[model samples]
Target: MHDFDWIYECAVIFYVVSLLGYFIDFLQNNRKANRFAFWLLSIVWVLQIIYFFVTLMQINRFPILTPYEGLYFVSWLIVTLSLLINWFSRIDFFVFFANIIGFIMMSVYVFSPETELLPFITETMTTELFFMHIAMAFLAYAAFTLAFVFSLMYFIQYEILKNKINFRRLGRFGSLPELEKMSLFFTMIGVPLLLISLIWGAIWGHLTLDTFFYFDAKVVTSIIVLMMYSFLLYMKIMKQEHGKKLALINIAAYLFLLINIFLSQSFSTFHWW
Candidate 1:
């Protein structure tokens, strides 16, 4: 058993309770329940942060290779995103959906076998730049996810308007202009972040590896994803494209981004999954 096994169990329990609270709010529109769930989720985030850092300190490397670690990280990201969205926007039911996703990830992690980091990776001559590269990449991913969520909100709002679905709560989603602007803003932020991450990754690669190729599956796919988003940004800003069509393009680009994630994982030479 891990030293922090109890912490992980507590986090899981809190996550389950938080999901139950969110479900209650979703069904009955209970603000108090929502607030309770929000705080519980916040606690879970704190626990996750504590556990992540403690493990990193113990392992002395980025220990995110195994399925359990991946699921935990994804779940934490979802909670973080959900909380940020709740704080920044008036989008209704987003928190509910986000927590649901987080819960599913956590459940799978719980059922999966516990595992350790790959020994060779931990023994690799990693530098601060390697950590920076990973950090920037994670930030870029978070920014892209935020953009995707906003773009998704745009579509949902558009459909509601188009269908004349008059659920009063639907008004909580920001207007199309707001959602679109937010999406663009986050994408702009993400593009530079990803570029910086790539730069750092390349530097670290050159420093540590015998042969560093830009054509590696992960790097190539990353560059392609970057270009796709860049093209979308240019189309929207330079060509003055807007509305549901642009949102659809943004959504499609994000889907491709998702594909790049799994595709690169499958074939990457140096990526630690």
Candidate 2:
């Protein structure tokens, strides 16, 4: 195998080890295990960076055209977000779930069937607008995913609070207030990113396809997803909507977004992948 491939495999192994460390920390609340998890994940991130750069050099373009590459990018985004949350808040609970997502993404990428690399710049995908659109869209997706996780955490904590259940046995999960803040933070960030992505996508389509807009399934679904989040944010910030209602809205929006993404290719003419 090539050196980059070896590095990739090693990164995967390190991620697994890091995940185990986090799991142990969750189970036993061990500070050492938490530290180990952070350090191991840092190593994995470094290795992944090296592997990504090597692959970029080989491909001579962004390695995001294939499913495997997309998975890798998503996994990296989740890991990066997890690390940031840990650094800022010393909250490792999010890291546990984020790494679970990262592991699944990496596993899918490793096992998925390989496809031959296309030429460095295919006509349809070569534009700066296209690249911007894809990047912003995926970043928005990652943010929304984090928001979804936080919302789920909020609901769990809310339930515990309502029942007056002891939280001491629940590991390192955040308090309801913390979870609420984080969820709102992610949603606030995600909405603008998604809006920007849509704008770029429209520009790309107009420049390449001679159409400024189309009422395609992907387009319509994306708009719906955007509007739902916008409403959620509006109600939360402007009307002071809180608690179960906000959490449920966030959860429902994220679920709709996921479904839209999964079914988009089947019905949308513009997005095939």
Candidate 3:
């Protein structure tokens, strides 16, 4: 367990260095710098994989039940998946969003005055299926985090266009079409995973000691968010909406999701570190 903690600490250091490289790359539009950032990010991802396995060795079971482990794993999944996407597509558009999300979460873990792990979160509330369910939930949310950032950039670019602002820095990034498509792609992937998580959560809730309809405030808010995203999906699929409008909707959906996660954590007695 102590070794796992050391691994996690190393991961935080890698994340900080990667974040700095990403910032420099973004600011200077330096391809070589971005490549270095990606390499560091890749190393972090590999180390995280080792940490995950080490955790399994220590706990002798999956580490998905506790919010601390769950959030950490989900963030790792997001970065790993993003790296894979960039590798296959040869597109760096997701890199910025990925770095920002990764850095924010890593920072929270590193600097938050409390970083203790909760044994009871797993010992008390966890089930095999429930663990899998939350893993899916957070993984989807992490991807949505990346998409949200991209959508934000799109909207900012749109605003600049609308206002005839002269921001040459924005011009250096991917075009509106490219960013919108990427954002839409990620949102499209996240929605169904979130839906599955919702269903699994209900099943797990019923199996737990809690009442079937306890429906914590976070759960209700999450359902609402799911509906909101579903509506956006309907608009995009049936109504053929795309581009800036779709991007804006994506941004709205992520905001709702973010709020739901924060509020959900509030309701949870378990540590959400």
Candidate 4:
């Protein structure tokens, strides 16, 4: 376990270095900085994978059963997805924002309660259904995090355009249409994944606890989050809404999700840390 901690700390250091590279790229539009960021993030990802498997071996199960572990996994997912996005889309700005979120999450994890193997594993948590439920749920949260970043960029670009601000100064931020497209694209992906996660969670609950739903605060807030994003997608598709309104909606939903994540553990029995 100490070895795993050491490796995890090393990965966090590399991630911070990568973030600095990205920040330099953002400020100066330097290609070398961008390349350094990509390479450094790649190294951090590999180290994190090592740390993940090591911790899993130590714990004798998945590493996401606790809040500390979950945050670490979520940060890993964010970085992995950001790398993929960068590889395919070459969207440097997207990668920047994504890693900014990743950096913040990793920083939080460094201060989070230390993760230790549980004294005993519960039968309910050991099942494949529960594992998939938790994994997919966290992945969905990661996707939503990306969507939030893109929506924020969209709003910033929108404001600049509406106020007739200097386009030259903000040109590196990417065009408004591109930002909007990415925002909607991520929302489309995250909503369906979240739905599937909820379905599997319900199935797991029914199989283990003989209950389809507990109506706990986490469960209720999760449903509301699902509905909120569903509405955002519906409005975009059916009502033909776009621009600031959609971006604002996405931001609002993300804020609510953050609240649910932080506060639900205190009040909800099912999802407590």
Poorest stretch of ten by lDDT in candidate 3: 109-118
Provide the lowest-lDDT 10-residue window in model 1. 117-126
Tell me the tens digit of each residue's lDDT in model 1 across 25-73.
Answer: 7677788988999899999999989888988897766655453565677
Q: What TM-score, computed on C-alpha atoms, does each candidate reach?
A: 0.86, 0.92, 0.86, 0.93
Give candidate 1's TM-score.
Answer: 0.86
Runs of candidate 1 exceeding 4 Å displacement: 62-78, 101-120
Q: Global lDDT of each model?
A: 0.79, 0.84, 0.73, 0.84
* Per-candidate alpha-carbon RMSD to the true structure: 2.7, 2.1, 2.9, 1.9
- lDDT of candidate 3 over 1-273, digit per residue (tens): 364578778887887887778778667777787788889889889888988898788777776654456666667877887788778764454676666776666555545443344576556455777776787788788768777767887887888889999765676556788777777777788889899988987887777745565466767877888887788789888999887888777888888887876567687542242
Find the candidate with the highest TM-score and give its number. 4
Clashing pairs in 1: none
lDDT of 2 by residue, 100-168 (tens): 877887898888877764454365786788888888888888898898888887788788878999767
Model 3, residue 171: C-alpha shift (Å): 5.6
The 10-residue segment of model 4 with minimum total lDDT is 115-124
Alpha-carbon deviation at 263 in model 1, angstroms:
2.9
Two-way lDDT contest, 2 vs 4, winner: 4
When 1 and 2 are scored with TM-score, the better candidate is 2
Name the regions of candidate 3 deviating beyond 4 angstroms. Answer: 90-93, 111-124, 164-172, 268-273
- Tens digits of per-residue lDDT, candidate 4, 1-273, equal 375688888888888888899888877778899899899999999998998898779767888877777888989999898899888875577788888888888888788767554454455576898888888888889989999988998898888888988755376667788888988998999998999988998887877774544678888999999999999999999999998999999999999989777788788866644
